[model samples]
Target: MTTTQSSISSTSPTPTVPSGSGRVANIVLDSFTEAGRHVRIIPRNIEVLIFATIQPVMFVLLFSFVFGGSIQVPGYPDYDQYLMPGIFAQTVVFGSVFTSVGLAEDLSKGLIDRLRSLPIVQSSVLIGRTLSDLVRNIITFIAMLAVAFVLGFRFEGSLTSAAAATALLLLFSYGLSWVQALIGLSVGSVEAANSAGFLWMFPMTFVSSAFIDTRNLQYAWLRTVADVNPFTQVTNAARALYNGTDPGDAVMWSLVWSIGLVVVFAAIATRKFKTSSE
Candidate 1:
Protein backbone atom coordinates (compact mmCIF):
# COMPACT_ATOMS: atom_id res chain seq x y z
CA MET A 1 0.00 0.00 0.00
CA THR A 2 2.91 2.35 0.89
CA THR A 3 4.66 1.43 -2.42
CA THR A 4 1.42 2.03 -4.34
CA GLN A 5 1.00 5.46 -2.71
CA SER A 6 4.64 6.35 -3.46
CA SER A 7 4.30 5.29 -7.12
CA ILE A 8 1.11 7.34 -7.54
CA SER A 9 2.83 10.39 -6.04
CA SER A 10 5.87 9.89 -8.29
CA THR A 11 3.72 9.88 -11.44
CA SER A 12 3.00 13.14 -13.25
CA PRO A 13 -0.24 14.88 -12.41
CA THR A 14 -3.21 14.64 -14.77
CA PRO A 15 -2.75 16.65 -17.97
CA THR A 16 0.85 17.38 -17.09
CA VAL A 17 1.35 20.62 -18.97
CA PRO A 18 4.97 21.67 -19.58
CA SER A 19 6.59 24.95 -18.52
CA GLY A 20 8.53 27.85 -20.15
CA SER A 21 9.57 27.30 -23.76
CA GLY A 22 8.46 23.67 -23.65
CA ARG A 23 4.93 24.79 -22.76
CA VAL A 24 4.81 27.25 -25.65
CA ALA A 25 6.03 24.59 -28.07
CA ASN A 26 3.49 22.10 -26.72
CA ILE A 27 0.64 24.58 -27.20
CA VAL A 28 1.64 25.32 -30.80
CA LEU A 29 2.07 21.64 -31.73
CA ASP A 30 -0.97 20.40 -29.84
CA SER A 31 -3.17 23.13 -31.32
CA PHE A 32 -2.19 22.16 -34.85
CA THR A 33 -2.69 18.49 -34.08
CA GLU A 34 -6.18 19.13 -32.76
CA ALA A 35 -6.99 21.33 -35.75
CA GLY A 36 -5.79 18.57 -38.08
CA ARG A 37 -7.98 16.02 -36.34
CA HIS A 38 -11.06 18.15 -36.90
CA VAL A 39 -10.14 19.12 -40.46
CA ARG A 40 -9.33 15.59 -41.60
CA ILE A 41 -12.72 14.22 -40.63
CA ILE A 42 -14.49 17.02 -42.52
CA PRO A 43 -14.60 14.89 -45.69
CA ARG A 44 -16.52 12.12 -44.00
CA ASN A 45 -19.15 14.63 -42.90
CA ILE A 46 -19.77 16.03 -46.36
CA GLU A 47 -23.46 16.81 -45.96
CA VAL A 48 -22.96 19.24 -43.09
CA LEU A 49 -20.23 20.96 -45.04
CA ILE A 50 -22.39 21.05 -48.19
CA PHE A 51 -25.33 22.65 -46.42
CA ALA A 52 -23.14 25.22 -44.72
CA THR A 53 -21.78 26.31 -48.10
CA ILE A 54 -25.17 26.18 -49.75
CA GLN A 55 -26.87 28.57 -47.31
CA PRO A 56 -24.57 31.45 -48.31
CA VAL A 57 -25.00 30.63 -51.98
CA MET A 58 -28.75 30.75 -51.62
CA PHE A 59 -28.57 34.07 -49.81
CA VAL A 60 -26.43 35.46 -52.62
CA LEU A 61 -28.93 34.31 -55.25
CA LEU A 62 -31.98 35.51 -53.40
CA PHE A 63 -30.62 38.98 -52.70
CA SER A 64 -29.13 39.36 -56.17
CA PHE A 65 -32.25 38.19 -57.97
CA VAL A 66 -35.21 39.35 -55.91
CA PHE A 67 -33.86 42.42 -54.22
CA GLY A 68 -31.29 43.53 -56.80
CA GLY A 69 -33.91 45.05 -59.13
CA SER A 70 -35.38 47.52 -56.60
CA ILE A 71 -32.38 48.24 -54.40
CA GLN A 72 -30.44 51.24 -55.74
CA VAL A 73 -27.61 52.99 -53.96
CA PRO A 74 -25.85 56.14 -55.15
CA GLY A 75 -22.61 55.52 -57.13
CA TYR A 76 -23.27 51.78 -57.47
CA PRO A 77 -25.11 51.20 -60.76
CA ASP A 78 -24.84 47.44 -60.38
CA TYR A 79 -26.07 46.39 -56.97
CA ASP A 80 -24.30 43.02 -57.14
CA GLN A 81 -20.91 44.51 -56.32
CA TYR A 82 -22.30 46.43 -53.38
CA LEU A 83 -24.28 43.38 -52.26
CA MET A 84 -21.58 40.71 -52.47
CA PRO A 85 -19.32 42.06 -49.76
CA GLY A 86 -22.16 42.34 -47.26
CA ILE A 87 -23.21 38.77 -47.97
CA PHE A 88 -19.64 37.62 -47.46
CA ALA A 89 -19.41 39.42 -44.15
CA GLN A 90 -22.78 38.15 -42.94
CA THR A 91 -22.09 34.55 -43.90
CA VAL A 92 -18.70 34.38 -42.24
CA VAL A 93 -19.93 36.09 -39.11
CA PHE A 94 -22.72 33.55 -38.95
CA GLY A 95 -20.12 30.87 -39.55
CA SER A 96 -18.63 31.60 -36.13
CA VAL A 97 -21.72 29.89 -34.73
CA PHE A 98 -20.15 26.63 -35.82
CA THR A 99 -17.38 27.03 -33.28
CA SER A 100 -19.83 27.28 -30.42
CA VAL A 101 -21.99 24.41 -31.64
CA GLY A 102 -18.99 22.22 -32.34
CA LEU A 103 -17.50 22.84 -28.92
CA ALA A 104 -20.76 22.15 -27.16
CA GLU A 105 -21.13 18.96 -29.18
CA ASP A 106 -17.64 17.88 -28.21
CA LEU A 107 -18.40 18.51 -24.55
CA SER A 108 -21.61 16.51 -24.78
CA LYS A 109 -19.67 13.61 -26.27
CA GLY A 110 -17.07 13.70 -23.47
CA LEU A 111 -14.37 14.75 -25.91
CA ILE A 112 -13.40 17.61 -23.62
CA ASP A 113 -12.82 15.13 -20.80
CA ARG A 114 -10.79 12.94 -23.10
CA LEU A 115 -8.67 15.92 -24.13
CA ARG A 116 -8.13 16.89 -20.53
CA SER A 117 -6.85 13.42 -19.71
CA LEU A 118 -3.88 13.91 -22.02
CA PRO A 119 -0.65 15.75 -21.15
CA ILE A 120 -1.32 18.76 -23.36
CA VAL A 121 -2.13 22.42 -22.88
CA GLN A 122 -5.84 22.68 -22.02
CA SER A 123 -6.28 25.93 -23.94
CA SER A 124 -4.93 24.37 -27.12
CA VAL A 125 -8.20 22.49 -27.54
CA LEU A 126 -10.11 25.76 -27.84
CA ILE A 127 -7.50 27.23 -30.15
CA GLY A 128 -7.62 24.14 -32.33
CA ARG A 129 -11.41 24.24 -32.52
CA THR A 130 -11.45 27.90 -33.55
CA LEU A 131 -8.67 27.26 -36.10
CA SER A 132 -10.51 24.34 -37.70
CA ASP A 133 -13.71 26.35 -37.91
CA LEU A 134 -11.73 29.14 -39.54
CA VAL A 135 -10.59 26.60 -42.15
CA ARG A 136 -14.19 25.61 -42.83
CA ASN A 137 -15.08 29.32 -43.09
CA ILE A 138 -12.35 29.78 -45.72
CA ILE A 139 -13.75 26.90 -47.77
CA THR A 140 -17.22 28.37 -47.53
CA PHE A 141 -15.97 31.82 -48.52
CA ILE A 142 -14.28 30.50 -51.68
CA ALA A 143 -17.48 28.78 -52.76
CA MET A 144 -19.47 31.98 -52.20
CA LEU A 145 -16.95 34.00 -54.24
CA ALA A 146 -17.39 31.64 -57.19
CA VAL A 147 -21.16 32.02 -56.99
CA ALA A 148 -20.87 35.80 -56.65
CA PHE A 149 -18.81 35.93 -59.86
CA VAL A 150 -21.48 33.95 -61.65
CA LEU A 151 -24.01 36.54 -60.49
CA GLY A 152 -21.97 39.28 -62.23
CA PHE A 153 -20.23 40.49 -59.12
CA ARG A 154 -16.92 42.07 -60.07
CA PHE A 155 -14.18 43.38 -57.85
CA GLU A 156 -13.36 46.80 -59.30
CA GLY A 157 -10.28 46.83 -57.06
CA SER A 158 -6.92 45.31 -57.80
CA LEU A 159 -6.51 41.61 -57.03
CA THR A 160 -4.27 42.52 -54.12
CA SER A 161 -6.94 44.79 -52.65
CA ALA A 162 -9.57 42.10 -53.08
CA ALA A 163 -7.29 39.65 -51.33
CA ALA A 164 -6.83 42.12 -48.53
CA ALA A 165 -10.61 42.42 -48.21
CA THR A 166 -10.99 38.67 -48.00
CA ALA A 167 -8.26 38.49 -45.38
CA LEU A 168 -10.01 41.16 -43.32
CA LEU A 169 -13.28 39.26 -43.36
CA LEU A 170 -11.56 36.04 -42.35
CA LEU A 171 -9.70 37.82 -39.59
CA PHE A 172 -12.92 39.27 -38.25
CA SER A 173 -14.62 35.90 -38.38
CA TYR A 174 -11.66 34.31 -36.62
CA GLY A 175 -11.98 36.80 -33.81
CA LEU A 176 -15.70 36.11 -33.45
CA SER A 177 -14.86 32.41 -33.19
CA TRP A 178 -13.11 33.15 -29.91
CA VAL A 179 -16.28 34.81 -28.62
CA GLN A 180 -18.18 31.67 -29.57
CA ALA A 181 -15.61 29.59 -27.71
CA LEU A 182 -16.46 31.38 -24.50
CA ILE A 183 -20.18 30.85 -25.07
CA GLY A 184 -19.64 27.16 -25.77
CA LEU A 185 -17.67 26.67 -22.58
CA SER A 186 -20.31 28.51 -20.58
CA VAL A 187 -23.28 26.61 -22.02
CA GLY A 188 -24.38 23.18 -20.83
CA SER A 189 -25.57 21.64 -24.11
CA VAL A 190 -25.22 21.87 -27.87
CA GLU A 191 -28.82 23.04 -28.21
CA ALA A 192 -28.26 25.77 -25.66
CA ALA A 193 -25.10 26.87 -27.41
CA ASN A 194 -26.86 26.99 -30.78
CA SER A 195 -29.71 28.98 -29.36
CA ALA A 196 -27.57 31.38 -27.36
CA GLY A 197 -24.91 31.78 -30.02
CA PHE A 198 -27.35 32.86 -32.76
CA LEU A 199 -29.60 35.00 -30.61
CA TRP A 200 -27.56 38.12 -31.31
CA MET A 201 -26.49 37.22 -34.86
CA PHE A 202 -29.50 38.52 -36.79
CA PRO A 203 -29.60 41.86 -35.05
CA MET A 204 -25.84 42.12 -35.32
CA THR A 205 -25.81 41.38 -39.06
CA PHE A 206 -29.04 42.87 -40.42
CA VAL A 207 -28.91 46.01 -38.37
CA SER A 208 -25.56 46.83 -39.97
CA SER A 209 -24.64 47.62 -43.59
CA ALA A 210 -25.03 44.00 -44.68
CA PHE A 211 -27.98 44.51 -47.02
CA ILE A 212 -28.08 48.29 -47.58
CA ASP A 213 -26.28 51.48 -46.70
CA THR A 214 -26.73 52.53 -43.10
CA ARG A 215 -26.77 56.11 -44.41
CA ASN A 216 -30.11 55.33 -46.02
CA LEU A 217 -31.63 54.30 -42.71
CA GLN A 218 -34.37 56.78 -41.77
CA TYR A 219 -34.33 56.31 -38.03
CA ALA A 220 -31.45 58.22 -36.47
CA TRP A 221 -31.04 55.84 -33.54
CA LEU A 222 -31.15 52.79 -35.81
CA ARG A 223 -28.64 54.40 -38.14
CA THR A 224 -26.41 55.21 -35.20
CA VAL A 225 -26.51 51.61 -34.00
CA ALA A 226 -25.66 50.29 -37.46
CA ASP A 227 -22.91 52.87 -37.86
CA VAL A 228 -21.35 51.91 -34.53
CA ASN A 229 -21.66 48.12 -34.94
CA PRO A 230 -18.25 46.46 -35.30
CA PHE A 231 -19.73 44.36 -38.11
CA THR A 232 -20.47 47.57 -39.96
CA GLN A 233 -16.79 48.46 -39.91
CA VAL A 234 -15.87 45.09 -41.38
CA THR A 235 -18.56 45.18 -44.07
CA ASN A 236 -17.85 48.79 -45.00
CA ALA A 237 -14.12 48.16 -45.19
CA ALA A 238 -14.67 45.10 -47.36
CA ARG A 239 -17.06 46.99 -49.62
CA ALA A 240 -14.62 49.86 -50.08
CA LEU A 241 -11.75 47.49 -50.85
CA TYR A 242 -13.80 45.51 -53.37
CA ASN A 243 -14.90 48.70 -55.11
CA GLY A 244 -11.40 50.20 -55.20
CA THR A 245 -12.60 53.11 -53.07
CA ASP A 246 -10.91 54.57 -50.01
CA PRO A 247 -12.05 52.86 -46.78
CA GLY A 248 -10.98 55.89 -44.72
CA ASP A 249 -11.15 54.86 -41.06
CA ALA A 250 -13.21 51.73 -41.73
CA VAL A 251 -10.25 49.49 -42.57
CA MET A 252 -8.21 50.55 -39.57
CA TRP A 253 -11.19 50.25 -37.25
CA SER A 254 -12.02 46.80 -38.61
CA LEU A 255 -8.52 45.55 -37.87
CA VAL A 256 -8.61 47.12 -34.43
CA TRP A 257 -12.01 45.57 -33.65
CA SER A 258 -11.00 42.11 -34.88
CA ILE A 259 -7.75 42.10 -32.95
CA GLY A 260 -9.49 43.47 -29.87
CA LEU A 261 -12.19 40.79 -29.97
CA VAL A 262 -9.58 38.07 -30.33
CA VAL A 263 -7.47 39.33 -27.47
CA VAL A 264 -10.32 39.96 -25.05
CA PHE A 265 -12.41 36.88 -25.79
CA ALA A 266 -9.48 34.46 -26.06
CA ALA A 267 -8.39 35.42 -22.57
CA ILE A 268 -11.91 35.03 -21.17
CA ALA A 269 -12.53 31.75 -22.97
CA THR A 270 -9.20 30.31 -21.86
CA ARG A 271 -10.00 31.14 -18.26
CA LYS A 272 -13.48 29.67 -18.55
CA PHE A 273 -12.05 26.54 -20.14
CA LYS A 274 -9.62 26.01 -17.28
CA THR A 275 -12.35 26.52 -14.73
CA SER A 276 -14.71 24.15 -16.50
CA SER A 277 -12.05 21.50 -16.73
CA GLU A 278 -11.39 21.74 -13.02
Candidate 2:
Protein backbone atom coordinates (compact mmCIF):
# COMPACT_ATOMS: atom_id res chain seq x y z
CA MET A 1 0.00 0.00 0.00
CA THR A 2 2.81 2.48 0.93
CA THR A 3 4.71 1.59 -2.31
CA THR A 4 1.54 2.05 -4.39
CA GLN A 5 0.78 5.42 -2.77
CA SER A 6 4.31 6.67 -3.42
CA SER A 7 4.18 5.62 -7.07
CA ILE A 8 0.75 7.30 -7.61
CA SER A 9 1.92 10.54 -6.00
CA SER A 10 5.13 10.58 -8.04
CA THR A 11 3.27 9.98 -11.32
CA SER A 12 0.55 12.55 -10.64
CA PRO A 13 0.40 15.46 -13.09
CA THR A 14 1.54 18.83 -11.80
CA PRO A 15 -1.32 21.22 -10.86
CA THR A 16 -1.68 23.63 -13.82
CA VAL A 17 -3.85 26.25 -12.20
CA PRO A 18 -3.79 28.01 -8.88
CA SER A 19 -6.91 27.69 -6.77
CA GLY A 20 -9.00 30.80 -7.37
CA SER A 21 -10.74 32.48 -4.47
CA GLY A 22 -14.13 32.11 -6.15
CA ARG A 23 -16.05 32.51 -9.45
CA VAL A 24 -14.90 36.06 -10.10
CA ALA A 25 -12.24 35.02 -12.58
CA ASN A 26 -14.63 32.83 -14.52
CA ILE A 27 -17.24 35.59 -14.60
CA VAL A 28 -14.74 38.11 -15.95
CA LEU A 29 -13.54 35.71 -18.63
CA ASP A 30 -17.09 34.97 -19.65
CA SER A 31 -17.89 38.68 -19.76
CA PHE A 32 -15.12 39.42 -22.23
CA THR A 33 -16.06 36.36 -24.27
CA GLU A 34 -19.62 37.61 -24.54
CA ALA A 35 -18.49 41.12 -25.45
CA GLY A 36 -16.31 39.74 -28.23
CA ARG A 37 -19.24 37.75 -29.53
CA HIS A 38 -21.41 40.84 -29.61
CA VAL A 39 -18.79 42.81 -31.52
CA ARG A 40 -18.30 40.04 -34.04
CA ILE A 41 -22.01 39.63 -34.68
CA ILE A 42 -22.68 43.36 -35.08
CA PRO A 43 -20.06 44.15 -37.70
CA ARG A 44 -21.18 41.15 -39.71
CA ASN A 45 -24.44 42.97 -40.40
CA ILE A 46 -22.77 45.63 -42.52
CA GLU A 47 -26.08 46.62 -44.03
CA VAL A 48 -27.28 48.34 -40.87
CA LEU A 49 -24.15 50.51 -40.50
CA ILE A 50 -24.21 51.29 -44.20
CA PHE A 51 -27.69 52.71 -43.71
CA ALA A 52 -26.44 55.08 -41.00
CA THR A 53 -24.19 56.89 -43.44
CA ILE A 54 -26.73 57.48 -46.23
CA GLN A 55 -28.68 60.29 -44.55
CA PRO A 56 -25.58 62.09 -43.27
CA VAL A 57 -24.06 62.17 -46.70
CA MET A 58 -27.33 63.19 -48.34
CA PHE A 59 -27.77 66.09 -45.93
CA VAL A 60 -24.16 67.19 -46.26
CA LEU A 61 -24.20 67.20 -50.05
CA LEU A 62 -27.66 68.68 -50.44
CA PHE A 63 -27.10 71.46 -47.90
CA SER A 64 -23.38 72.09 -48.29
CA PHE A 65 -23.13 72.15 -52.07
CA VAL A 66 -26.62 73.32 -52.94
CA PHE A 67 -27.66 75.82 -50.25
CA GLY A 68 -24.14 76.52 -48.97
CA GLY A 69 -23.34 78.52 -52.11
CA SER A 70 -26.20 80.88 -51.39
CA ILE A 71 -26.31 81.02 -47.59
CA GLN A 72 -23.39 82.58 -45.73
CA VAL A 73 -22.45 82.51 -42.06
CA PRO A 74 -21.25 85.73 -40.41
CA GLY A 75 -17.65 85.96 -39.10
CA TYR A 76 -16.69 82.84 -41.02
CA PRO A 77 -16.12 83.97 -44.59
CA ASP A 78 -16.51 80.42 -45.89
CA TYR A 79 -19.82 78.69 -45.29
CA ASP A 80 -18.15 75.28 -45.28
CA GLN A 81 -16.27 75.97 -42.06
CA TYR A 82 -19.40 77.12 -40.29
CA LEU A 83 -21.51 74.33 -41.73
CA MET A 84 -19.12 71.40 -41.30
CA PRO A 85 -19.26 71.23 -37.52
CA GLY A 86 -23.03 71.48 -37.40
CA ILE A 87 -23.20 68.92 -40.14
CA PHE A 88 -21.01 66.56 -38.15
CA ALA A 89 -23.24 66.95 -35.10
CA GLN A 90 -26.33 66.40 -37.19
CA THR A 91 -24.91 63.29 -38.82
CA VAL A 92 -23.72 61.73 -35.58
CA VAL A 93 -26.94 62.62 -33.78
CA PHE A 94 -29.18 61.09 -36.40
CA GLY A 95 -26.98 58.01 -36.79
CA SER A 96 -28.03 56.81 -33.33
CA VAL A 97 -31.07 54.98 -34.71
CA PHE A 98 -28.97 51.95 -35.53
CA THR A 99 -28.38 51.29 -31.86
CA SER A 100 -32.09 51.37 -31.14
CA VAL A 101 -32.93 48.99 -33.93
CA GLY A 102 -30.10 46.66 -33.05
CA LEU A 103 -31.08 46.50 -29.41
CA ALA A 104 -34.73 45.94 -30.19
CA GLU A 105 -33.91 43.13 -32.56
CA ASP A 106 -31.62 41.48 -30.05
CA LEU A 107 -34.31 41.64 -27.36
CA SER A 108 -37.05 40.38 -29.65
CA LYS A 109 -34.94 37.45 -30.80
CA GLY A 110 -34.14 36.36 -27.22
CA LEU A 111 -30.47 36.91 -27.92
CA ILE A 112 -30.06 39.28 -25.02
CA ASP A 113 -31.76 36.88 -22.61
CA ARG A 114 -29.64 33.97 -23.76
CA LEU A 115 -26.59 36.08 -23.10
CA ARG A 116 -27.90 36.89 -19.63
CA SER A 117 -28.20 33.24 -18.76
CA LEU A 118 -24.51 32.70 -19.27
CA PRO A 119 -22.21 32.97 -16.22
CA ILE A 120 -20.95 36.37 -17.32
CA VAL A 121 -20.95 39.88 -15.97
CA GLN A 122 -24.40 41.47 -16.32
CA SER A 123 -23.08 44.77 -17.70
CA SER A 124 -21.01 43.02 -20.33
CA VAL A 125 -23.91 42.75 -22.75
CA LEU A 126 -24.65 46.47 -22.68
CA ILE A 127 -20.97 47.34 -22.77
CA GLY A 128 -20.54 45.11 -25.77
CA ARG A 129 -23.50 46.68 -27.56
CA THR A 130 -22.32 50.18 -26.76
CA LEU A 131 -18.79 49.37 -27.88
CA SER A 132 -20.08 47.87 -31.10
CA ASP A 133 -22.17 50.97 -31.74
CA LEU A 134 -19.12 53.12 -31.13
CA VAL A 135 -17.29 51.14 -33.79
CA ARG A 136 -20.13 51.80 -36.26
CA ASN A 137 -20.11 55.49 -35.35
CA ILE A 138 -16.39 55.65 -35.97
CA ILE A 139 -16.83 54.11 -39.39
CA THR A 140 -19.64 56.52 -40.25
CA PHE A 141 -17.70 59.50 -38.92
CA ILE A 142 -14.67 58.55 -40.98
CA ALA A 143 -16.81 58.24 -44.09
CA MET A 144 -18.37 61.65 -43.46
CA LEU A 145 -15.00 63.24 -42.72
CA ALA A 146 -13.59 61.90 -45.94
CA VAL A 147 -16.58 63.17 -47.92
CA ALA A 148 -16.39 66.57 -46.24
CA PHE A 149 -12.70 66.87 -47.08
CA VAL A 150 -13.46 66.09 -50.70
CA LEU A 151 -16.12 68.82 -50.62
CA GLY A 152 -13.59 71.47 -49.43
CA PHE A 153 -14.29 71.55 -45.69
CA ARG A 154 -11.20 72.67 -43.79
CA PHE A 155 -10.44 72.83 -40.07
CA GLU A 156 -8.73 75.88 -38.59
CA GLY A 157 -7.78 74.34 -35.26
CA SER A 158 -4.46 72.77 -34.27
CA LEU A 159 -3.99 69.02 -34.39
CA THR A 160 -4.65 68.75 -30.66
CA SER A 161 -7.96 70.56 -31.02
CA ALA A 162 -8.95 68.28 -33.88
CA ALA A 163 -8.22 65.25 -31.74
CA ALA A 164 -10.22 66.64 -28.84
CA ALA A 165 -13.09 67.45 -31.16
CA THR A 166 -13.10 63.89 -32.45
CA ALA A 167 -13.10 62.47 -28.94
CA LEU A 168 -15.89 64.79 -27.81
CA LEU A 169 -17.98 63.99 -30.86
CA LEU A 170 -17.57 60.28 -30.19
CA LEU A 171 -18.50 60.74 -26.53
CA PHE A 172 -21.67 62.53 -27.50
CA SER A 173 -22.41 59.74 -29.97
CA TYR A 174 -21.84 57.12 -27.27
CA GLY A 175 -24.19 58.86 -24.89
CA LEU A 176 -26.90 59.10 -27.49
CA SER A 177 -26.30 55.48 -28.41
CA TRP A 178 -27.03 54.43 -24.84
CA VAL A 179 -30.23 56.43 -24.80
CA GLN A 180 -31.31 54.73 -28.01
CA ALA A 181 -30.37 51.37 -26.57
CA LEU A 182 -32.81 52.01 -23.76
CA ILE A 183 -35.47 53.01 -26.24
CA GLY A 184 -34.79 49.89 -28.28
CA LEU A 185 -35.18 47.66 -25.25
CA SER A 186 -38.57 49.21 -24.51
CA VAL A 187 -39.90 49.19 -28.06
CA GLY A 188 -41.96 46.37 -29.61
CA SER A 189 -40.07 46.02 -32.87
CA VAL A 190 -37.00 47.13 -34.76
CA GLU A 191 -39.17 49.09 -37.19
CA ALA A 192 -40.66 51.09 -34.34
CA ALA A 193 -37.17 51.70 -33.01
CA ASN A 194 -36.03 52.99 -36.39
CA SER A 195 -38.99 55.33 -36.87
CA ALA A 196 -39.03 56.57 -33.29
CA GLY A 197 -35.32 57.35 -33.36
CA PHE A 198 -35.73 59.51 -36.43
CA LEU A 199 -38.95 61.07 -35.11
CA TRP A 200 -37.00 63.14 -32.58
CA MET A 201 -34.65 64.53 -35.23
CA PHE A 202 -37.17 67.01 -36.65
CA PRO A 203 -37.63 68.80 -33.37
CA MET A 204 -34.20 68.19 -31.85
CA THR A 205 -32.11 69.18 -34.87
CA PHE A 206 -34.48 71.39 -36.89
CA VAL A 207 -35.76 73.42 -33.98
CA SER A 208 -32.25 74.00 -32.65
CA SER A 209 -29.62 76.39 -34.02
CA ALA A 210 -28.60 73.86 -36.63
CA PHE A 211 -29.47 75.40 -39.98
CA ILE A 212 -29.63 78.96 -38.61
CA ASP A 213 -28.20 81.00 -35.78
CA THR A 214 -30.15 81.33 -32.57
CA ARG A 215 -30.05 85.13 -32.88
CA ASN A 216 -31.95 84.95 -36.18
CA LEU A 217 -34.77 82.74 -34.91
CA GLN A 218 -37.86 85.00 -34.91
CA TYR A 219 -39.98 83.11 -32.43
CA ALA A 220 -38.87 84.08 -28.93
CA TRP A 221 -39.68 80.71 -27.40
CA LEU A 222 -38.09 78.79 -30.24
CA ARG A 223 -34.98 80.94 -30.05
CA THR A 224 -34.69 80.36 -26.31
CA VAL A 225 -35.12 76.64 -26.74
CA ALA A 226 -32.57 76.55 -29.54
CA ASP A 227 -30.06 78.49 -27.51
CA VAL A 228 -30.42 76.01 -24.65
CA ASN A 229 -30.62 72.84 -26.71
CA PRO A 230 -27.93 70.26 -25.98
CA PHE A 231 -27.61 69.69 -29.73
CA THR A 232 -26.74 73.36 -30.11
CA GLN A 233 -24.27 73.13 -27.28
CA VAL A 234 -22.57 70.13 -28.90
CA THR A 235 -22.51 71.82 -32.28
CA ASN A 236 -21.14 75.04 -30.81
CA ALA A 237 -18.43 73.13 -29.05
CA ALA A 238 -17.52 71.29 -32.24
CA ARG A 239 -17.49 74.59 -34.08
CA ALA A 240 -15.27 76.18 -31.49
CA LEU A 241 -13.02 73.17 -31.47
CA TYR A 242 -12.73 73.17 -35.26
CA ASN A 243 -12.33 76.94 -35.65
CA GLY A 244 -10.05 77.30 -32.64
CA THR A 245 -12.51 79.84 -31.25
CA ASP A 246 -11.27 79.87 -27.67
CA PRO A 247 -12.20 77.13 -25.16
CA GLY A 248 -15.48 78.23 -23.62
CA ASP A 249 -18.66 77.20 -21.83
CA ALA A 250 -20.05 75.42 -24.87
CA VAL A 251 -17.43 72.71 -24.59
CA MET A 252 -18.02 72.40 -20.86
CA TRP A 253 -21.77 72.24 -21.30
CA SER A 254 -21.50 69.67 -24.04
CA LEU A 255 -19.36 67.43 -21.87
CA VAL A 256 -21.71 67.87 -18.93
CA TRP A 257 -24.76 67.02 -20.99
CA SER A 258 -23.12 64.02 -22.61
CA ILE A 259 -22.01 62.64 -19.26
CA GLY A 260 -25.44 63.24 -17.76
CA LEU A 261 -27.12 61.42 -20.64
CA VAL A 262 -24.83 58.39 -20.36
CA VAL A 263 -25.49 58.19 -16.63
CA VAL A 264 -29.25 58.39 -16.92
CA PHE A 265 -29.66 56.05 -19.87
CA ALA A 266 -27.08 53.63 -18.57
CA ALA A 267 -29.03 53.24 -15.34
CA ILE A 268 -32.24 52.55 -17.19
CA ALA A 269 -30.48 50.20 -19.60
CA THR A 270 -28.93 48.29 -16.75
CA ARG A 271 -32.30 47.74 -15.11
CA LYS A 272 -33.88 46.63 -18.35
CA PHE A 273 -30.89 44.44 -18.99
CA LYS A 274 -31.38 42.75 -15.63
CA THR A 275 -35.14 42.29 -15.85
CA SER A 276 -35.54 41.59 -19.55
CA SER A 277 -37.40 38.32 -20.14
CA GLU A 278 -36.29 38.32 -23.72
* Positional deviation of residue 228's Cα in model 1 after best superposition, in angstroms: 0.3
Q: Write the per-residue lDDT of candidate 2 for residues 101-153, one digit (tens) a residue.
A: 87888878988778776656787677667776777677889988998899888
Question: Could you tell me every candidate's TM-score relative to the true structure?
Answer: 0.92, 0.85
Superposed model 2: Cα runs more than 4 Å off: 1-35, 41-43
Q: Give the per-residue lDDT of model 1 (tens digit) for 1-278.
A: 33444565466666644554777888999999999999998878999889988999999989989999998888789888888999999999989999999999999999999999887888999999999999999989998899898888888999999999999999999999999999998899999999999999999999999889889999999999999999999999999999999999999999999999999999999999998745
Give residue 204's error in model 2 in angstroms.
1.0
Error of 1 at 174 (Å): 0.6
lDDT by candidate, in order shown: 0.92, 0.79
Write down the RMSD of all candidates, one decimal each. Answer: 5.1, 7.2
Q: Which candidate has the highest lDDT of all?
A: 1
Show the colliding residue pairs in model 1.
Answer: none
